[model samples]
Target: MINAGIIGASGYTGGELMRLLLNHSEVNIVAATSRKLAGEAVTDTHRHLKGFLDLGFQNLTPEEIKSACDVVFVAVPHGTAMDIVPELLDDDVKVIDLSADYRLKTAAFEEAYAMEHRDPRDAVYGLVELHPEVAEQNFIANPGCYPTGATLAAAPLAKAGVISSVIFDSKSGITGAGINPSPVSHYPNMAENVQAYKLTTHRHVAEFVQELNRLDNSLTNISFTPHVVPSIRGILTTAHVFTKEKMDVDGVRKLYEDMYRDKPFVRVLDGSPSLGGVRGSNFCDIGFEVDERNNRIVVVSAIDNLVKGASGQAIQNMNMMCGFDETKGLWSAAAAP
Candidate 1:
């Protein structure tokens, strides 16, 4: 069994990692660190995992965590992962980062995030379906919630040379903000509110555009907008595309189905998919509509931000790194409302 350790265990992504790893037969969660919750029982900080994990949230240095586990998951914020990852890389440990630090290969974007590139020129991108080989071999950079949804929606169209350009309008639940409570995430304020916060300047834009372009050079341009909705979990991404030629909706669905047939985590919805269907699961549910008159197509993708978007993907990376079944501990069905 591979021993795993998670840094920043008090946050949403970190806690989700704990929940998923606890059920993995090949994994033994060795340590989880949080300075504020140091020495506290894991169950005390995250009651959802009551009786599942007995380990305490110890406050340990990066090196101390490296020594405790064969693999480490950096579940901290964007800038913070850069600081911790470089230190942990020195030890013989694999890292699956849940941040934007290593997702963009360009140095310019690193400066935009106020982080200096300290690791090797290469850290694998963890979009499991597209890059399964990378997922199996090395340390990974998990894709952002919005990018994951947007890319999967358009990748099939892009590969077929059917779309001229794409526009993405995505909505995410409050948990996407993090475990820490904020005014924006407050129930009273967020209820009945649908606000677009990061318009053109969102950091996730660079990743979405870059990765899509990387997948197909024919996808010349993309416009993305992200918003926060009132729900507690899930991300719904709608991709609007202008097709180069007329294509039947069934034909398009077949393309997506074929592309992801071998992929276990992605679900191609027969009709529109709501966040509720994918809640608490690692599935990226996709559905679409075709407007032949306007030469446009609209596709919707849904996922639980904490699961498919973050920690669940992290464990998926670990499964690949350790040569275990990709669905080892992630086969739990979605929780119904």
Candidate 2:
């Protein structure tokens, strides 16, 4: 079994990684690291994983972690990961960064986050459905939560080279902000509100543009705006795709189906996608409809931000990098009501 280690094991994504890796047939989680929470039971921070994981959060250094683990998941925040990632990447280990550090081209990352990229190296962008090349790499940069859903919603159209312009309006749950509670997460501020922060300047736009541009570079018109709703998990993206020519409903459906037919985690459905159906699962449920009158197609996608958007996708990369079946531990149903 592959021994896995997760750095920054106190956050939402880290906890989610542990939760999913528990069932991995070829994995044994050996170390969970958190400098501040060292020696404490991992359950102290992740009460939901009370019985399944008994490992304590260790304060292991990069060398120690690399020695003990075959795969290392960097689950720290964006800026912080750049500092830790370089030390972890070497001959013996595979590192999957669940951060924005290596997801973009170094220049784009520096421009978006307004920080110098300490380690500017080539790492496969771990959007497995589109980039099947992760199976050949030692390091992967997991896609951002918003980009995962938003990009998946419009990817078929983009890849078909029929997209004239795409505008994405995404609503994500409170947990996307992370484990720390902030003003927006306050009960009174968030309970009945739909707060749209960073209307045009949200940093994740870089990732959305990066992935779509990769599919169709000449397709320049891409825009995104993000909102935070009262829910705790999942991201629902509604994409308004204006095409060069009118696409019929059957044709549009065929595009999505043909693109994702062999992809295990992307479900192309007849109707619109909803968060409830994909919560706590690695699936990205997508649906689209053509509007003949406007020469446009409306596409929607849903995914658990913690799952397909973060930790679960990280493990999916791990499976591919390790040459295991892609769905070794992740082929399961969502926790729907």
Candidate 3:
């Protein structure tokens, strides 16, 4: 069995990691760390994982975790992974960081995020469908939740040269902000409301542009807008693109279906998929409508912010890194409301 460890194991992503790893047959969860709940039973803190992990949360040093596990998942904040990933690499432990630190290859984007690129040489972007090779080779840089949904929604058309330019409008549940309490997450304020918080300056903009740009260098123009809805989980991405040539709805659908024919996680839907349909699974459900009237295409994609967006994708990377089935631990279906 491959030994696994989770650093910064108290947040939503960490908790989801624990839940998925519990059912993962090939993984032996060696350590789960949390400064606040160190030495406490992991279940005591995350009631959902109470009986799954009998071990207590340990406040472990990088050396300690390196010695105990074959791989370490750095699920900390954007600026923090740079510090922990380097030390883990020193011990030869494959690192899968779920942060913005290593996602973008361009140094300028790193500066825009306000975090210095410490180990710029080691990390790889971990969008499993697009960068399966990265998962096979070295340290993985898991894509942000919004980026995952948005990129998958548009990549097929971009590759086929079906669309000239893409505009992505994504809405995510409040949990996408993290477990921290903020004025934006105030219960009264968030309830019965839908607000667009990060209009133009959201950092994921760099990631969306960088990934699509990599696919087709000529595809330059991309517009992205993200909003925070009152719900607790899931992300829905709606992309609008103008086709280079007039394409029928069935033709566009066939293009997407053929693109994802071999991919297990991305599902193309006939009708609009609800957030709850993909809430607890790694699937990115996509559906589209071709506006023959305006010669445009509108596509919608949905994923659980914490699952496909974070922990589940992290596990998918682990499966690829360790030569296990990509859907091994992620075979469970989405939660139904």
Candidate 4:
């Protein structure tokens, strides 16, 4: 069994990593670190995982983590990861950072995140379906929750080089902001309300552009806007993709089917994908329609923000990097109503 460790194990994503790893037959969770709750039971903070996990939160150093684990997942915030990652990588232990710290080019990262990168290197972008070669690397940089859904919604068309421009309007749950409570996540403000933030300047827009551009270098007109919905999980992205040529419904369906036919987690649905269909699961459900009159393809993709979007995706990366089955720990079905 692969011995795994989680740094920053008190946040939403960290708790989620603990939850998923506990069920992985090939993995043994060795350490879960938290600075503040160092001596507390992990279940105290992650109440949902109380009965499932018997581990306590420890305040372990990078050396301790490297010694105890074959792999380590950095679940800290974006800027924080850079500090811990450099230390973890000094050893033979595999590192998977669930942050934007290593996802972009060094120059692009400094501009979008507005922080100088201390230890920038080319780590594989861990969007498993789009780039499965992660199986060959020991380090992976996990994609953001928004980018994962938005990119998947339009990737096939982008790769076919049929898209001229793309606009992604995404609605995400409050949990996307992390476990920290803010005025936006305040129950009074978030319940029954949909507030749009970072209309044209959200940080995740950079990733959507970067990934799509990698597929079709000439494609550049990509726009993204994000909204906070009242739910606590999942991101539903509606991609308004404009093509150079007029395409029919069957043609578009074939493109998506052919692209995702070999992918395990990306489900091409007959109808629109809903948050409930993918909540609490490591699945991205995609469905689309061809607007022949307008020459636009309306594609909808849904994924649990905390699962496929974050922690579960991190575990997925770990599975690949360790040469285990991609779906080893993630074989469960979506918890839908």
Candidate 5:
């Protein structure tokens, strides 16, 4: 069994890592760390994992985790992970960071996140579908939740080199905000409300551009806007792709199908993609249509923001980096109504 450890284990993502790792057949969770909850039963914070996990949260140092775990997941907040991840590397242990720290180049990261990067190192951007080369690396920077859904929605068109520009509009569950309660997360304010923030300046946009630009360098006209819905787990992204050439429905369908055929987690849906179809699963369900009159194709993609968007994807990276079957634990069906 691959011995794994989770650092910063008191939040939504950390709890999710434990919940999902319990389902992984070949994994043995060794340590789960949390400064505030040190020595507390993990179940206190992650009640869903009560019966399955009996470990207590630790305030272990990096050397302690690296010595005990074969693989480590750094799930701390953006600025915080930069400090922890560097210490976890340089050993036999493989590391996957679920924060924004190592996802971008130093300059871009500093610009987008507005923090100086202390550890400037290279990490494979772990979008397993697009960058399968992560299998050869010891360190991976898991893509951000918003970027995971948004980029996958438009990647096929961008890779086909058929689109001149695209705009992504995404709605995520409140959990995307994290485990903490904000004024926006208040029940009175959040219920029956659709909140849109970071209109033209969300940091995840840089990630969207960074990943797509890898496919087609000249494809630079990308825009993104995010909204928070009243839902609990999924992100639904609608991508308006303006094509340079006229695209038909059949052709657009073929593009998405061909691109995702070998990617185990991405489903090219015959009907519309909905949050329900991909909730609580690592699958990315995509559907699209062509607007011949506007030289545009609208593609929609859905994923559980906490699963395919965060923890499950981090496990997917671990699976690849360890040479395990990509779908060994994640091939299950979504929890749909």
Candidate 6:
């Protein structure tokens, strides 16, 4: 079995990673690190994993991690991961970063994140469906939550080179903010309200643009807007895709079905996808319709932000990197009402 370690095991993404990895048939989680929670039971922070995991958090050094783990998952924050990942990559150990540190080109990352990238090495962007070549690399940079859904929604059209412009309006659960609490995540303000932030300049836009532009270099009118809903998980993206040439609903459906036919995690649904259908699962459910009159197609995509958007996708990359079955530990159905 592959021995794995998780860095920064106290946050939402970290906890989610632990939960998923605990059930992974081909992996054995050896070390989970958290400076603040060192010596404490992992269940203390991740109560949902109490019975499944009996391990405690450790404050292991880079040498300890390199010696004990064959693979390391960097679940720390963006700027923080850049500091830790360089040391972890010194050996032959595989590294899958669940941060934006290595997801973009060096210059684009620096500009979008507004921080200098200290270790700017090439890493496969771990959007498994779009780029399965992650199986060939030792390092992978996981895609952001918003970008995962938004990019999947429009990639077929973009690849067909029929898109004139695409606008992504995404609504995500509050958990996307992280475990930390702030005024933006406060219950009183968020409960009955829908708040839209980073209307035109969310950092994740860089990822969507980068992936789509790779498919069609002439496509430059991509725009994205992000909002926070009161729920605790999932991201639902509604993409308004305007095409250069008119296409009917059957043609659009055929495109999506053909693109996702072999991808295990992406489901091309018969109707619109919802949060409840994909909650707690590693699935990205997509549904769309064509508006013949306007020459536009509205595609909706849904995924559990903490799962498909982060940790679950991280493990998917790990599986591919390790040459194990891609669905080895991720075949469970979504939790629904």
- Model 5 C-alpha lDDT per residue in residues 1-337, reported as the tens digit of each score: 9899999989999999898899899999999999999989999889989789999999999999999999999999889988988788875999999999999989889999998999988789999999989999999999999999888989988899998999999999999999999987888899999999999999998899899999999998999999999998899999999999998888888888898889999988876799989888999998887889999888899999999999999999999999999987888898988
Instruction: Name the lDDT value of residue 83 in candidate 2.
Output: 86
Q: Give the per-residue lDDT of model 2 (tens digit) for 41-133.
A: 999889999989889999999889999999999998888988888888887899999989889899999999999999888788999999999
Please provide, for model 3 over 1-337, each residue's C-alpha lDDT reduced to its tens digit, 9 standing for 90 to 100.
Answer: 8899999988899999989998999898989999888988888878997657787888998889989988899989888888887788853577888988888774855656875677676466898888869645658888999999999999988888766888899999999988898988889888999888668778888888888887777887888889889899999999998878899977888889898998999999998877988989999999988888887899999999999999999999989987889999899888898
Q: Which pairs of residues collide in candidate 5?
A: none
**Candidate 6 per-residue lDDT over residues 137-193, each given as its tens digit:** 988999999999999999999999999999999999999999999898999989989
In candidate 4, stretches whose alpha carbon ends up further than 4 angstroms from where it belongs are none
Per-residue lDDT tens digits for candidate 1, residues 92-126, read: 78888888888887575675565566663567789
Q: Could you tell which candidate, 1 or 3, scores higher by lDDT?
A: 3
User: How does residue 14 of candidate 5 score in lDDT?
Assistant: 93
Candidate 4 lDDT tens digits, 1-337:
8899999989999989988988899889989999999899999999999778889999999888999999999988888888888788844689999989999999999999999999888989999989989988888999999999999999999999999999999999999988888999999999999999989899988899899999999999999989999998999999999999999999999999999998999999998999999989999999998899999999999999999999999989988888888898888888878
Best by lDDT: 6
Query: Which model is ahead, 3 or 4, in terms of TM-score?
Result: 4
TM-score of 2: 0.99
C-alpha local distance difference test of each model: 0.86, 0.92, 0.87, 0.92, 0.92, 0.93
- Residue 22 local lDDT, model 3: 87
Residue 51 alpha-carbon offset, candidate 3, angstroms:
1.5
TM-score for all predictions?
A: 0.95, 0.99, 0.96, 0.98, 0.99, 0.98
| Candidate 2: regions farther than 4 A off | none
Higher-ranked by TM-score: 1 or 6: 6
